[model samples]
Target: MGCEAPATVGKLVAVNTSGSYLWEVPLETEKPSGGFGCAPAAIPAAIYGTPAVEVEEGLVYVGSYNGKIYAINSSSGALRWVYPREGNLQPVVGGAVVALGRVYIGSSSGTLYALDAVTGDKEWEFQTGDKIWSTST
Candidate 1:
């Protein structure tokens, strides 16, 4: 998967230490951006931020400008689940944080969401009244 940020669709890649690919998964947006013709971003990202890899859980979590989050199998490219299986949220520009079986992330809508790591269910949410761009390191 190319890490270059795309306005519409991007990809998440798992590479070995030797710079070889282990797996690649596509990242898509539910809403299209106006800037669709530009080249990919130089930084490593699915669309806006770096993807979160949870090795112990065998899952890779990524957010898109389409306001959606996806959980993919770490070893395989199979998609495990997606958040807001129906509607959409503000664009998710930050990476996810996985701890204590919860996936925490922020969206452009000025809210933070804590989702069930396994099922992508909304566990809770907090409104900050401002866009959140930073991710936990």
Candidate 2:
């Protein structure tokens, strides 16, 4: 899949870092004249929840308003996979937490999902009576 950010103006973040950004969510991929090519996954429309990174696994996990959880390569920011591969999950309002071998995240639908850290596969889910807006510890 591909993403094109809206032309509308938004915040321009400036990070004082020792290295350049890991990657840019591409708006368009370069045309391959006659060779193999790779395209990054689509970016979410909005993100309220902070992202969690698994250093040892080399993955950065983040949930989006589009109701999906994404596992991106930490060094390249290339999307590795997304949860509920078919998407359409409840809006992930809370940040994700990586522990043991799972990624735990909550949604506005009051459901918490536990996914495999390496694959973004659902291991299990829990439903609460109210929306889950707090980040999991």
Number of the top-ranking candidate, with TM-score as the measure: 1
User: Clashes per prediction?
Assistant: 0, 0
* Candidate 1 TM-score, C-alpha based: 0.78
lDDT of 1: 0.76
Cand. 2 Cα-lDDT? 0.68
Q: Estimate each model's TM-score.
A: 0.78, 0.73
* Residue 65 local lDDT, model 2: 61
Q: Give the TM-score of candidate 2.
A: 0.73
**For all the candidates, what are their Cα RMSDs to the real structure?**
4.5, 10.1
Q: State each model's CA lDDT, in order.
A: 0.76, 0.68
Residue-wise lDDT of candidate 2 within 14-123, one digit each (tens)?
12276543354421222222311122433333555788879899887877666667787767657788787873677666799999999999988889889999988889
lDDT winner: 1
- Candidate 1 pairs with clashing backbones: none
